[model samples]
Target: MSAGTGQRAAAPGPSTQKPRGIDRVLAFVERAGNALPNPVVLFTVLFGVVAVVSTALALADVSVTVPGTDDTKQITGLLTGAGVRWLVENLVTNFAAFPPIAAVLLMIMAVGVAERAGLLETAMRATLARAPRAFLPYLVALVACQAHMMSDVAAIVLPPLAAVVFKSAGRHPAAGLIGGFACVTAGYAAGFTIGSLDALYTGITQQAVAVLSDTHHADVNILANYFFTAASSLVLGLIGGFLISRVLEPRLPAYTATADAPDASESEDIRLTPAERRGLLCTGLVVAVYAAVVLSLWLPNGAPLRGEGGALVPSPLLTGIVPVLFGGFLLAGVTYGFTVKTLSGSEGVVAAMTDSVKNMSGYVVMMFVAAQVIAVFNWSNLGVLLAVKAAALLKSVGLTGFGALVAFILLVSCLNLVILSGSALWSLIGPVFVPAFMLLGMSPALSQAAFRIGDSATAVITPMNPYVFLLLALLQRYEPEARLGTLISRLAIFVVPFLVAWLGILAVFYGFDLPLGPGAGISLK
Candidate 1:
């Protein structure tokens, strides 16, 4: 029982009828999503919209009383001379200071070193080789879920690799591609450990929470959603594994390997050489030493990492997680790179870091627009005003509690179809919802957890995701005629179940009043 063989053995005969309803809906979604402007342009347009609305609101003297305060806050007009000066002064600073962009760029520097050294690919191959056939799908799903720690590296690497693994085991390669793509994109928010995304989202969440009250200015830990997301990874992996094994593979036409398919010998040749083995050993040693040092700074009695009054939540270790992540990854990557001879000297390491930043050129461009939009939104006070009004409306309609959380999840899930970037979406929506949820007695961490559920579940089926195109391109290698609809239809099967199961998990967490993460609970005190 080799890996993927059970899926090949269980393959059902092809069906004559098409799944018309799902196909139609997916086609419509694809068309509508593709019609949306590029994210950069979208953010630019949003910035203009915010400016116009802010001017109009200010002209109307629109004001909202601060919740738990008697003072009224008036909208600030971005078109005013004072606003113009503020914008000009802050434009560079906004882009330079945008937390997520900075964090992602820094993390990628280290990840790039590991990726260029071939450590990540080799590690994946080694892991797959050892995975039991009966649990191959589950293993692949788990690996894909965890791959978020490497950012887009998984999207670019996994689908083709999974296809190769399945094809070698006589399973439909497209099934493998879909399964890998599903977990990577659809389970994007669920990971075993904190990564760039946690850093990215937490920064956005903190900014949003800060707008409401200074007392709420506690720094959101990158691991704020750690416990829930760790559980989510398991659930997503299991559900994804089941769908890949039971539903997706059985329906696909039997795979006939094209010349374009990875050479069968490639999988056989994937063994780590002595040098690569040394690289892994060296990386592990370095990471262990780094972890020991970090723990020593945090775990001992009266350690410096502890917060004032010996609290952990606002501790220096949690607050300084981004730099710690950067340093840890940097050391691990350098160790592996040198061991494997991928890095000959400091020059090689510098090149890897430089290339990593070059890879983020598009993101950097998008962030410029995003930063301006966020700045204008903040200056206009529209986000605060909207949250205040929305909170009042929700209270009036009695939509608070678990039901409101459910609605919020559904809304963000739908929004995922049109907006693909999690950080971008969060930066746009977080201000409105974080405050509104807080007003309704939810913690920012809980609101963030709900956002993660919605943001991730629908990603696989959404054409708006930039990676879907990449997945489609990968699919074409096996199924020459495969269309966007093909991948969407295959991956869409898991989206509903994932959403339902994930929402159920959230409900249970709420019912039990479970902590979302260390020192982070479902409701504000």
Candidate 2:
């Protein structure tokens, strides 16, 4: 809520400045994107399209030579007896075995409980309050850049928290809310820590790699892009903060209290209560104890968490990270909830977890369709065939190096306008990109890193994401006449800035032949 009555002034409207060239581009992009169907429907349609295409290719006797091997792979018609049985037998299994399903759910359940118990809210709010006012935007931007670890909870959580933080610092709340929304959605791959999203993206990437080669291939883990992404958080965070504070806020109209307007503070303070403080203190202890337990299990070469001969990357500790997060959040959330009376008993804890799962209902529906489409694509040999063809083309053009990487980033960025789900987009394209790049002696990690840039840079301005509408709603509180166009224009300003910064970071990493993360170098060699 308002830090003072002076802060109770009615929020002003969005800028009345004339539309810029970028605004028109965003408008056209938004219109084209809005014409597409929902992701679930899109994926279902894609499944049918893939089946028909597979049948056509099969009838045409299409096949490709597997790279680095003498094996010939042929397209199989999805309408044939074997194909029909594969689809029928694997439909349920496809969804059940989908790589991201269990991981996303485990993550959501844990983050949800922490959110429900108010631990996340209190802790983040405290962090925001302690920061210098001049650095508020940077802090919010940085926090948002990392919030995906909390999964979709970040979508619902960060905006309002940001608003409160901004209001406390005597700045326009809309800037914080809108800026936070932009950073969270667009700069998703920019984070200092690995979280659920890493699992979701890499899980699909691993599946794609697995389907590409019959022989053993390098596996993608949650840490595949860790090193590069952590650096991106700071770079993009500064750019975002500079834009929001210096450019956007300065353009906002003046504020004045109005009886008809909602209270800027709504009479709430961000400071934690005595109860919350105690709860947080208890949660800290829970975390420390959990850390100690993890260290005990990981320190020894013979530990179950360690890999063969105690390697880290291929170890259970790395592979099973989502569950590890689930356990930590569960311990922290339950501890705080019970301590604060937000959760009364065992039933309360279970209920919190249940509510978190409920938040994933829509995603579950989308995943079901996506799983089937990907399954068919792999089984029909479309991904492998495309990879071979695309790789051969890249090599022929003498562009199978950074030129290819740059082109891949641009392609993914353009597609991101209409394809709202990063996981969905990657699932569709990763199979092709991973194998194609591998054939060029580039690692899947490099391909994945390219995707991170492409997805986030354009995703910031896309009207296709449902969250954009939610962001528009939040802006309407400050600017009652605010429309999707208004938000789109604001979002447009950040697109190039984000893209340029990301490209710079990517170029540096690529030029230096740096590791994207542990054992995930830019080149396969």
Q: Candidate 1 on 66-176: residue-level lDDT in tens? A: 787776778999999878999999999988887778777777787788777777887888777656666888888888888888787788888778877776666777877
lDDT by residue for model 2 over 1-525, one digit each (tens)?
121111223334334556678667766877787887888888888888989999999999999788778888899989989899998888899889988898888877887788888888788777776677899999998988888777766877788778767876778888888888888877888898666678778878877776665743786777889999999999989998998899887877774544534476652567778998899888998899998898778777787787887876578876777788789988999999999999878888889889988877888898888888878878899878888889999989888889998889999999999887788788778878888898888888889999988988888777666677776666666766666656777877888888889989999999999989877888875
lDDT of each: 0.81, 0.81
Clashing residue pairs, backbone N/CA/C < 3 A, model 2:
1-265, 2-265
Off by over 4 Å in 2: 1-24, 260-268, 481-483
Q: TM-score of predicted model 1?
A: 0.91
TM-score of 2: 0.90
Which one is best on TM-score? 1
Q: Stretches of candidate 1 above 4 Å error?
A: 1-19, 214-218, 480-483
Give model 1's clash tally. 0
